[model samples]
Target: MRGVVMYKPGDVRVEERDDPRIIEPTDAIIRLSATCICGSDLWPYRGAEPVDHQVMGHEYVGVVTEVGSRVHTIKVGDFVVGSFFASDNTCEICRAGYQAYCVHRVLMGALGTQSELARIPLADGTLVATPGHPAPDLIPSLLAASDVLGTGWFAAVAAEAGPGKTVAVVGDGAVGLLGVLAARHLGAERIIAFSRHADRQALARYFGATDIVEERGPAGVDRIKDLTGGLGAHSVIEAVGTQEAMMQAIHATRPGGHVGYVGVSHDVALPGNELFMSGVHLHGGPAPVRRFLPELINLIWNRTIDPGKVFDLALPFDRAAEGYDAMDKRAATKVLLTL
Candidate 1:
């Protein structure tokens, strides 16, 4: 089988690799129908995170080809979507709706779904079969549900975005843009998206952003404050993992508001005194995507929301390197790799 591997920063290649097979009784094997590059993959590609012949990609949607003896709910021939993390889904933490932190969780990135075939551990707990084989047009959105869409939905829920709430999102990446959509679907009265790119700004508005703030750092916070009459937003979603973005999100929310941060933190530190005085609730880490997969799949299947619009560029599977380059250079918002 062929899979994507990053030999080093700026060096991605499509190479032949051993095909995956069931190694656990609870595992299931799937032949990928479609997969895509994620914003987080850029961390290793840019050297911000170490890489040495590392397998890439996590978001995927595909048809099951094999299932272990313990995999009863998901069977061969089923079309499924799964989270980046494979969890037992029956653990205490999972029962509490935090499957991302399940006691028996497996990080799927290590298994690498960028390949033509993948072994999904804890199959019954990790994979969600669609209502039926999805339409070709719905495949991209179903694939999005495997990760980005679910993560964004989790972010919106954590921020308690709903009717009468003023929501502000502090990033314009796919997840943040989808956060706008989630906020809208959840009934946020106003949604503000922070972005400098005109294309992203337009997409953000299309996703339900009522306003766009191009500024960053203190200026960005001031702009958010100005829009909210100096009180700041009722909820803020931090989708960029940076010291500046984190602080901007924290300070951009009003007292007693909520800040849901889903960005993978990279060298971020919060000021104790300032955070204590802010009197805001902070919640977010790796999103419990499994908790929202069923609802997300139904929405995507019904065509109620189109998160697949994030993939502005699509390339053949062997051209995976080009997809990485396009994303790293910001030439594409998201890249979908066709099988």
Candidate 2:
């Protein structure tokens, strides 16, 4: 089989590799139908995250080709979507709706989904089978439900975006744009998107953003405050993991508001004194994507939402390097790899 492997920072290649098999009784093998690059993956591509000869890619939606003896809910021939983290959804932590922190968890990127085949552990709890094989066009959206959509949804949920709430999103990437969409779907009365790109601003408007702030740093926070009558947004979504983005999010949110940060924090340290005085709620980490896959799949399957629009580039699985390059250069919001 062929899969993507990161040889080091700024280097990734599609190379021949051994195929995967069920090494655990709870594992299942999936033949990739589609997969995509993630913003977090860029940390390694840009050398922020150290890399050796490690498998790459994680977002995936595929067909189950084999199942281990312990797998029951998922079976061979089932079309499934799963979170980046493989988890036994029934664990005590999972029961509390935090599957990303499940005591028994496996990071799927360790096996790499940007390949023709993948081994999914905890198949019963991690993989959610669609009602049936979906149409070809639906594949992209279904694939988004596996990661980006679920993560964005989790951000919106954590931010408490809903009716009567004023929401502000601090990123223009796929996850951030989808956070806008999720906020709208959750019934946010006002959605403010921070972006300067014309295309992204247009897409954000289509996703239900009522305002767009092109400024950066303090200016950006001021613009958000100006839009909200100096009180700031009721809910803020921080999709960029950086000190600047984090502070912008904190400043754009009103006192007693919520800030849901989903960006993979690279080098960030928050001041406890400021946080204590901010009078705002902060909650984030790896999203519990498994908790929202079912509802997200339903929305995508029914065409109620089109999160797949995020994939501005599509390539054959073999051209994954080019896909990575496109994203690293910010030429594409998201890149999808088809088998």
Candidate 3:
């Protein structure tokens, strides 16, 4: 089997690797139909996160080719979508809707889904079978359900976005754009997306953004407040895990509002005094995507939402390096790799 490995920052290659096989009684192996590069992958690619010949991707959607004895619900030949974090889905934390923090959770990135064949641990808990084998056209959307869409949906839900609520998104990446779509699906009355890129701004509008704020830091917060009649938004989604983006999201929410932050935090610190005075609720981490997988898969299968549109570039599996370069250069919003 061939898989993507980052030998070091700025060096990604498709190399032959041993094929995955069942390692646990609850494991399942799938032949990937499609997989894609994630914004988080860039962290290692850019040297922000250390990489030592690390396996590259986490988002995937594919057909099961093998299943362990304990994997009853998901069987060979089933089409499935799974989260970046594999969980038992039966733990106390999982029962409370926080599968991402399950006692037996495993980070799928370590297993690396950016390959022709990959093993899924805790298969019954992590993988959700689609209604049927998805058509070729729906594959991209199904693949999106694995991570970006799930994370965005979790962000919107955490922020409590719904009818009569004003939602603001602090980033313009695929997760943030899908956060816009999630806000709309949840019935947010007004959606504000902060983006300097015209293409992303257009996509934000298409996903239900009522306004676009190009400014960053304090200026972006001011724009959000100005549009909200000086009260700020009822809810804000922080998709970029930076001090600036986090502060922008926090300052852009009205007092007593909510801020859902899902970006992978990096050297971010919040001011205790300011947070105490703000009187806002903060929630979010690695999204409990397994909690929303069934619903999300249905929505994608029924074509109720089109999160797949976020993938602006597609490349063959062997050209995985090119896909990473495109994403790092910002030439593509999201890159889909075909197997």
Candidate 4:
């Protein structure tokens, strides 16, 4: 088997590795059909995380190759979409719709998807079997449901974004684009997107953004307010974890508006006094994507939403380094790696 490994920043390679065998009675092995380069993976790609020689990738849609003794929900030859955070779906936290914080959780990157085959723990809890081996066209959408689509949905939910309310989106990345989609799906009447890039602005419009702000910092806030008739939007989704993006989402929100942020936070620090006066409710973090997997799968299966449209670039799994480089250089909005 071959898997992606990152030796350090600017270095992701495909290396031959031993195939995984059942290590737990609840585990299952998958042969990836499609995987992707996520923004979070860039943290280590850019040296923001102390990544040593480790596997890379948590988003995948694949066929189950084998199953452990206790795995009943998923079986060999079944196609499935699993969450980045593996969880026992029946856990108390999962039952409460917080699978990301399942008492027993495992981050899949420690065992990545950028491989010919990989082992997934808690198969019954983590993997969602599709009705059947889907048409090739559905692969991208299902892959998105694995992470960005789910994350965007979480951001909108956290921000209290809903029908008839004005919403502002703070980033233009894939997650941000999907956030725009989520807000629109949730019934936001007005969607304002902050995007200086024309291509992103176009996609944002396609995703249902009503306005695009090209400014940054205070100017961006003013622009958002200006578009909202001097009042900030009722709900703002922050998809970028930077301080500037966070502050922009906060400052551009109405006094009682909710701010939902799902960016992977780095050095972001919020000013207490500002937040105190802003009167905006803030919530969001790495999404419990597993919680939303079932509903999202339904939406996709029914073709209600096409989140896979976010993938602008596709490459062979062996060319993952090129995919990473393209994303790092801003040449690709999102990359799909074929296995």
Runs with alpha carbons beyond 4 Å of true place in candidate 1? none
Q: Candidate 2 on 248-315: residue-level lDDT in tens? A: 99888899999999999978898888788888999988999999999999998899999999888999
User: How does model 3 score by TM-score?
Assistant: 0.99
CA lDDT of each candidate? 0.95, 0.92, 0.94, 0.91
lDDT by residue for model 4 over 1-339, one digit each (tens)? 989999988899999999999999999999888899998888888888888888988998899989999998788999999988899989889999889988899899789888888899999999999988898999999999999999999999998888889988998999999999999999999898889899999999998999998998899999988888898989999998999989999999989899999999989989999999999999998899998898999999989989898999999988999999999888998999987
* Model 2 stretches astray by more than 4 angstroms: none
Q: If scored against the real structure, what TM-score would every candidate get?
A: 0.99, 0.99, 0.99, 0.98
Model 4 residue 7 lDDT score: 92
In the predicted model 4, the residue pairs found to clash are: none
**lDDT for predicted candidate 3 compared with the true structure:** 0.94
Models, CA RMSD each: 0.6, 0.8, 0.6, 1.0
TM accuracy, model 1: 0.99
Off by over 4 Å in 4: none
Residue pairs in collision within model 1: none
Question: Candidate 4 — worst ten consecutive residues by lDDT sum?
Answer: 109-118
Q: Candidate 1's residue-wise lDDT over 50-86, tens digit each?
A: 9999998888899999999989899899999999999
lDDT of 3 by residue, 251-275 (tens): 9999999999999999999999988
Report the poorest 10 consecutive residues by lDDT, candidate 1: 142-151
